[model samples]
Target: MSKPFSQACENNKQPILDKLLVHFRQASRVLEIGSGTGQHAVFFAKNLPHLQWHCSDMPANHAGINQWLADYPSANLHAPVPFTIGQDSWPLELVVDKVDAVFSANTTHIMQRSEVPIMFDLIQKNLPEGGIFCQYGPFNVNGDYTSDSNRDFNQYLISQGCGGLWDIADLQVLVSGLDLLHQYALPANNKLLIWQKC
Candidate 1:
């Protein structure tokens, strides 16, 4: 089977990497949740050679993720372990030791809405003090969409029985042990939010 691809990933990888360079510079290992097509895993690992990028998604996605890794093959990029936010074990020790940073892109609106807070809870609980979590996706600000396209997209996701978009206000409560550090406005109406364990 051919490796999976995401055009969005191809387009935004570089811009995301630029910000990650600064936020994750001191991070030795990063756990990337919902690794989807594995494009970001390879790209980020190659660019940020200092970081050990470990990918995790549901079991069904592991094969496609491995395909990308085989083609690019970076020492810092490891195979994706099975991970379902509210189901599977955190896989923290399964992939690498000491996860100092966590990254997830375009996942907040894709997974079940109920699981969103769980994701935050796990990240904050597992990360050590000063550890960072960077999440990139289209998020609602104060329960409002930033643009018309995002509003339409949210409708589509709801029509398909997905979680639609997560409101920042709702998520703020879930980040108990984390403190908001930076929120960057990126292209395509997406925001890259960074938080640190406090």
Candidate 2:
């Protein structure tokens, strides 16, 4: 059976890719968090041949990600890895030094606000000096929702027992002590927070 496609993923991949190409030109060993369905992993690894892509997500999503990899296996694309953002012990057995960059898409809005700091701390611990962490999702700014669509989406997320949209300021404050630089605004009202470890 053919793998299912997510319309949102399809619509946003190219735009995300364009931004990645600009920042990831020299990056190697990219760790992708919340690699749902593995479409972005497959596409990015194929396009950015120089970077070794490590796709990861909750254990349940790893099987589907692995299946997606079967169709487009490449030297730079590692097998799907199991990772939970707030877990004390990561499931991966390898003891790598540090990743050059980390990328996550459409995940923050679904995770609790309190968990955000923990996730950032984990990313900081795993990233080497000058490493970049890129997160893509909808965000509120200055305590106000950016769009009506985002407001509705936030409500729906809460209804589904997930965390709603986060404010840019709130996230910035959470990462304030970390060695990070922020980049905001992205296509489709979604924001891309790029942090370069100092």
Candidate 3:
């Protein structure tokens, strides 16, 4: 069976890539969490040849990611890594050197609130000092939805049993001691949370 494609992923890939190119121009290895459809991994690896791209997701998503990455010949793009939020450890056998950056898109709102902190902790463990962690998604600011569209989307997501939009203030509090830095907003209602390990 052919793998499914997400239109939103296609629509947002370029704009996201543009921002990434600016901030991650010097990064060498990027660990991408929740690499759904493998589209972003392939597109980014192709564009940022200097940086090694590591695509990771739950085991079920690996097949589709492998299919998308099969055609890419760059030595920089590593095979998909099986990763899950809250897991005590990763599947990779060797403790490879810490990554330079970690990136995730549209994943935070789908995971439970408690899982978010665990995810950040894992990112902190895997990233080296000064490593960058970038997350993109719709978020609430000061406990209020940024737009009616986001509010509606939050309801829809919660109705489906997934976690809804998160509050920026809440998230900032979670990362308070992690030495993270917030970057400017993205094109969509989504914001990019960028941080570096101090």
Candidate 4:
């Protein structure tokens, strides 16, 4: 099968890696939720060889993700484990023994609002204390859009029946056990929010 591709993933991988190099430097095992097409998994695993990158997503996405992994074939990057945030058990415990960091990109705003909190709850339950969680996406600050493009994107998401841009303050409430560490304004009007498990 051919590899599935995401242009957004290709554009954002490098900048995301620069930050991961710092926040996840001490991490040995990283769990990437919603691995999507697996482009980021391969790119990040190739660049950050020290950390074992485990990709997980719903079963439907696995084939495309695996195809991407097979082409790049990083020793540190593993295949996607079937994970349905609120339904499935944490894949880390089933696949690897543990994970010290968690990463997700462009997932939150597309997920149903109910699933967003569930994802965080699972991260809180499974992520070890002091573990870092990196969430990259467009988000509102204090319930206000940062740019017109993001406002439009939110409308598009809502039209698609997905949850729209979540306010940072609202996310903070959902992420109860994790402390917000850094919020980086990335290119394309997106933001990368880092949190540490308390």
Query: Which candidate's TM-score is highest?
Result: 1
Please provide TM-scores, in order, for all candidate models, with all chains considered together: 0.97, 0.92, 0.92, 0.96
lDDT of 1 by residue, 1-198 (tens): 888999999989998999999999999999999999999999999999998999999989999999999999999998998889889767957434979899999998998988888899889878889999999999999879999999999999999989989887778876699988888999999999999999
* Model 3 lDDT tens row, 1-198: 587578878878888888789779879888898998888888888899889888888888988888888865567887788888876474453246557888899999998878888888887777777778878889999899988989999999999988889898888788643564765576668888787777
In candidate 1, which residue pairs clash?
none
Name model 2 segments beyond 4 Å from true. 88-94, 177-184
Q: Point to the candidate with the largest lDDT.
A: 1
Assess each prediction's global lDDT (C-alpha) against the native: 0.91, 0.81, 0.81, 0.91
Error of 1 at 145 (Å): 0.7
Q: Candidate 1: what lDDT?
A: 0.91
The 10-residue segment of model 1 with minimum total lDDT is 88-97
What would the per-residue lDDT of candidate 2 be over residues 1-198, giving only the tens digit for each residue?
457467888788888888889889879889888899998988888889998998888888877888889987988998867788777444344345357888999888898777778888877766778788888999898999989999999999999989889887887778743444556677678977788876
In model 3, where do residues sit more than 4 Å from their true spots?
A: 91-94
For every model in order, what is the number of clashing pairs? 0, 0, 0, 0
Poorly placed runs, candidate 1 (over 4 Å): 92-96
> For each candidate, C-alpha RMSD in Å?
1.2, 1.9, 1.7, 1.3
Give the Cα-based TM-score of candidate 4 against the true structure: 0.96
lDDT preference between candidates 1 and 4, better one: 1
> On residues 37-105, what C-alpha lDDT tens digit does candidate 4 reach at each position?
999999999999999999999999999999998889988888898998768878745345788899999
Residue 87 in candidate 2 has what lDDT?
73
